[model samples]
Target: MTRKASGAPGQDGHDDLQRNLTNRHIQLIAIGGAIGTGLFMGSGKTISLAGPSIVFVYMAIGIMLFFVMRAMGELLLSNLQYRSFIDFSADLLGPWAGFFTGWTYWFCWIVTGIADVIAITGYAQFWFPDIPQWLPAIACVLVLLGLNLLTVKLFGETEFWFAMIKIVAIVTLIGVGLCMVFSGFVSPAGRQASLANLWNDGGMFPNGLMGFFAGFQIAVFAFVGIELVGTTAAEAKDPERTLPRAINSIPVRIIVFYVLALVAIMAVTPWRDVVPGKSPFVELFVLAGLPAAAGVINFVVLTSAASSANSGVFSTSRMLYGLSLKGDAPKSFGTLSSRSVPSRGLMFSCICLLAGAFLMWMIPDLMEAFTLVTTVSAILFMFVWSLILLSYIAYRRQRAALHQASRFKMPGGVPMCVACLAFFAGILVLLTLKDDTRQALIVTPLWFVLLGVAYQFVRRRAVAGVVAIQ
Candidate 1:
């Protein structure tokens, strides 16, 4: 997919999107984006699947994804005119690459948004048990849509606070867990609090090869939004400075948020006892003789889900807007509101998201449907990520001078891209081992098939128009 060195279309380093995102906003957005509901809620399921080895799962995924982020950061900073990887894909790979990458990324977020809305409804049930689940789901979507429609800065501020709550909660949890470990606190189950809990029961890989492999299925979903910072390049006031700083801190964030937080939870309560569906964080707090903290943790998890959903709306609309600018989607989507927001695209995505939420409501088997939706989302996200890596490969091969000129060049370069791609492939293979994910893996191809068909029609129409003009 490499191309000759050529300037990208609309390569002026300016756009309709307002560059109001300062370094602080970008930094927090990166942090907020990386920390998702998956950590707060989904980790319970992952812990159950992989036992104590879930720590390794988070670390491995973080390392591989950090490389992916490095590749993305290099590509984005290579040319300031490139809004995101989607733009670079178009320029470096081809229009079809851009179309597929943009739309697949959009679809990924929409599916994720559906999951978040459902999670939000479940969380709302804690306070209002009598209320229908659908009510909170609808209210959440509507409210987030309204807020996002106002301004991009508002989205940043919202995520900033949402991420702060999560950070505070984790810090508190870690502090409490440390105290318990040092003071020799014991859980009600008589499980002594100790760091050895990570491997004492049956070693780190207690679940053996199969269980560790199975953990990847759920753990990969936890990292869906890790690349979200790249999307903000267009709106970032100083992408070169802000994007690098945000990306460079990924290892540290992963250590604190994912690794340390999970370690704390498992140490306080044995991984074998961690409920699959229930939140471990909430349980740990309750075990520590602070039942009220369960509600507070619930609120944090609720906000975390909302933040991810809010991000879904923001990212999906922007992706659609970028696609439209490339003549890959309806022109209406490219139109920006007076506030420079992609209102039309945002509304369209919200409508589709509402439809998804409605379908989830109508379905009798919620868990079954959710499993399929999430698996599909994860697969599509992998495709989008692969495209970014592929685009980076093309950028490096075709634009040699550009690579040499880059200050934030990807560390491992092509070998790292190949490794990440291999890792993603390994995840797909692991998906085939489970019945739940296997079904989604089987059905996931239909999406790419549809995209291929759409591309052919788009290409035919494009050729016909070009001939008609001639």
Candidate 2:
């Protein structure tokens, strides 16, 4: 089950700094990455905007993404040679593929980090209505820095607890929602609500084909950090066993947390009553006669936001570390500290996060900044997912003879990967509508332009260094 490392770790002056992240930490961190605070808060808007059709949107995207993960899983399980998806891209495509994959991924995490910080301020406003939003945002940034700076296991354990809060909250919600659906819980309106509400409003596809498609556009955002589980492969205790087990559960988790949860919600409350500005989750427990529901949800959601931002830091830092090792990033970032953590890379990302927070704070128009940041992140994540699939296709093409001899193989093979790309391209086209999602479309391309510029700089340095040596 032990596969060899693809390349020896680059001597970053602190080889001992690598952390021993335990299985528990990785498990919870994977779960934490999957649970976005946006789902807790933003789902109401999606429901309101798309109605019952949102359920289908979640399911469709889930199926497509599950295939994407399966491809990654089979590839990673096949050989321990690849570190991150970037390494796989390099091995499958070329060294330049690694450069683009690594940087795009780094940007993906950075943008996600910005969004998480925005979500923190937005979530904080629920409790501290009077406090200037930036204060809590600043404090949370500092808190994230201090927490991550200690050690990887601590970060993992910390994310484990954060993810747990969100997980428990979600399970409780699904349970309560089911009770209301079957047992007839009396709502705030003094009337009984039940399963009939789901279809009675207009059936599951009330939004029509377009509505269903629109739902996918918004729903895809909930699945943004899902790739984080694969990124942890390099640090896994026994990746061959743990990676497959962890990944195999994604479809179930996605269905339970997203699809079923959405079904239960619209079933109880109807799609129209769901609002975009507030959480239907909080409203649900309140409707179910729990006065302290707001308090309980607040605590859960606070952790959800923190968990996302925390994972953002972890993922981005690790990506940079991986990039540094591949000769794509500044050598300083490759330095792992004494705690076995990538101290320099970790600090670099945290500093960038704080800078991101300041930009949003200074803007004053929080909504615009939040939208631009998140949409860009979603687009970048899609790019990364696309690359992973492309890498798989390349892996199969190059290693056909070898793979034929291996046991772990990607199901549906080339066709599945091609379909995933088509699905992503459709999402890209959907991004052009100048409403809630248009900013993402605009900014996402700009990000690539920036990456292209940086790619040139790195390529030149790499060429010059080789020439001088010769």
Candidate 3:
């Protein structure tokens, strides 16, 4: 799997991206990536689906994905020349691996970005009911685009603060929740807050095996951007130090944010009473007698959605720039602004995000549109994670000397990669059993088929142009 150091023309010793992302920026970016709108808005649905068992679901996904990130970290640090998993995939597997992984990751972010835009519109409606939904969606895209086009440092700063807000909100919620539980706080519905709520009604697996399985599809979607730190490898100031610290904190983030937050919500409200399609965080605050809960949660959720969309634009643009440099995308996408930003690629991704706003205008039922797109996004993200694992397997085999000599090697190596892959396959099977997820699962393959067709055309043009140059 080893390739020439050049890998390909225009790809060797030619990174235009600035390493302005300091240790703080990288850590926060990774933290921001882990905490998205999913926990704020999607947890209710998961709670409704799997009850208290959802805690275990979040933990399982987090643990498995940590291994995926470990593999990604090892690959990125193996050669300072590699930027992200996309680069190493191309170097270790072939150019096709880079093309497919890069484009698929871009698509994944696009889908997520669109969903976030639609969510922004909905959140705005809470404050300005008469305002048209598409306006806010469009406005959100424009603002993020403007900021991203300026400099990579600004993007990092924006995420740092956005992630800070989310962290503060969750910590506050947990603290308030613990008080409610200890004080025996009683809600308007007459239920008393207690840890016993976890098992009182029907136990953890309240809905049984099928119900537990139902949680996986949505739960997988909740952790969509967990691997986003990989994309910042090109711009991170200290990839070896910061990257490992960020990746190592996954377990703590999972426990603090997802597990404890959900535990708090259920402890106050009970699994059976948790409403579907509504944010449990808001509900907990309200149940705890916070008059400003609605306004506060609305503001927090709005920021969470915006943060996700901002991340999408940053990651997808970088991916396009990477692809272009490899000759897998248009040459123009490789151009950089004076600030070392991929301005053209950023604009291109923002233009695609406009399609999301268009969908909000066209689809009367915004939630339905969000559901379909998010499911597809989840499926596409799974493919990207699988590629990282597969690439790790290849890296271990083909670059055994590097693997043995490296200080930041993946803990479990080949066997761990295989286990994570199997776990992901199990989630796919779970998706098939649910009607909503099944539809997306069926639609997901078409994306790969399209990528395959596009790859052939690109490869053909490369070969023909080379022959002509000769």
Candidate 4:
């Protein structure tokens, strides 16, 4: 199939972003986004906090985000010229919506990148206990930066393999875990593996309602990048075909990768026995008397962290590229390199990622640092998702013809959009119930305040430029 250029020509006569990502790239990118570093590293903490009820936490978030992706898919397909949700948001809502959504989305990934960096450092400690945590963190940032600087297609290929690793590890975990349950495998801790382990200890809601609420604090982080395919609309080959295929598979991915994997881990290890600081995936393999397999699981999870960071780097640069085109960001960000990648934005994001190493240096406790950053990332992501829903609502109102015409119309339309918004608000209220999350929540508004100020300045400068030109 012949592909058309998705971006306009720049001063140097190079296309903005090439349509080099095929259906396979989009499919794997969706999978990579569905399974995140939080699932591999933070799920242990979630299980420890919410016990078996953490399953429900993940299911609820996944279902809501599936709807968000549906809304995004429909909007992106409504107009092929729309580079991403940011473009539609600007058109359907206003310029401010685009500016806020664009920059906020960029910040979301930067913060998420930091969390992934911290996760990579923690996962590295699992293999090399004596190594400095900051070393691995900085090394990962540099490696991903180089790969991303080469080409957008290379970024897609890199994510394809990274995501494949996560898929194999999760499938292996679920399969091995089920075998142990069926064979009545006994662990070194004298616990027999069984499906009943889910509730046999203290029932599914072992820690009660508050425990269930606490689960959202980190479980939301696991779904941070679920809407990432929305960001690839500009570069995805035959987006109308690939985007829907990718979005439609989300439910299955969540059921298998998240719900089933967690079920398997809990069945083997039991909720109470799972260590909050260590990955339950590695722990499950160790309990199965395969220390070698446990080491392999550790490596898989380290790669998972790298995958999430890689997505963060890719999306943030693209978002900056979008923002700069609209004059919401500096013009330098809008320029593409000779390779057709956003090298300037890539470098900026990588420098921000190095702060992860600095964070590790400042906060010696890995989990503590991870929780704080992931919480902040989650909150900012919620804002971006909310804007997507809001844009959908506006689209439905103003462009009813577009809605009726869309082959990929959002299921349930505006009602579902409002419901999802309510669900997000509930999660925010839940965030206030804990000290760690509440601390992050309290500081989140400061981001919006800063954005408000910056928007005014940008608007004035844009008006002045037009006046000067006239």
Using lDDT, give the best candidate's number. Answer: 3
Q: Which TM-score value belongs to model 2?
A: 0.93
TM-score: model 1 vs. ground truth: 0.96
Backbone clash pairs for candidate 4 read none
Better of 1 and 4 by lDDT: 4
**Candidate 1, 1-470: lDDT as tens digits:** 11111123334447778787888888888888788787887899999889988889989989989999999999988888887889999999999999999989999999999999998998899999999877898899899999998888988888788888878998999999999999999877789999999988999988898999989998888888888998889988788899999999999999998999999999988899999988899898888899597789889999989989988999999999898877788878888888878898999999888899988888898888888888898899999889989999999899999999999989989999999999999999999998989999999899889999999998898899899999
Local lDDT at 409 for model 4: 89
- Clash pairs, candidate 2, are 17-340, 17-341, 18-340, 19-340, 45-276
**How much is 189 displaced in model 1, in angstroms?**
2.1
TM-score of each: 0.96, 0.93, 0.97, 0.95
| Stretches > 4 Å off in candidate 1 | 1-12
By lDDT, rank the candidates, best first.
3, 4, 1, 2
Residue-wise C-alpha lDDT for candidate 2, range 315-370, written one tens digit per residue: 88778877887778888777766566676777888788878878777887877777
Measured with C-alpha atoms, the lDDT of residue 129 in candidate 1 is 100
The Cα RMSD of model 4 versus the native structure comes to: 3.2
Tell me the whole-model lDDT of each prediction, alpha carbons only: 0.88, 0.78, 0.90, 0.89
For model 1, state the Cα shift of residue 72 in Å. Answer: 0.7
Residue-by-residue lDDT tens digits, candidate 4, 1-470: 12222357545433368788999999999999999888988899999999999999999999999999999999999888788889999999999999999989999998888877877887788889999877898899999999999988999999999999999999999999999999999987799999999988889999999999899888998888988999888888688899999999999999999999999999999899998978898888877778597679878988988998899999999998888888889888877777878888899989988975585668767667667778999999999999999999999999999889999989998999999999999999999988889999998999999999999999999999999999
Residue runs of model 2 more than 4 Å from their true location after superposition = 1-19, 130-132
Between candidates 2 and 3, the TM-score winner: 3
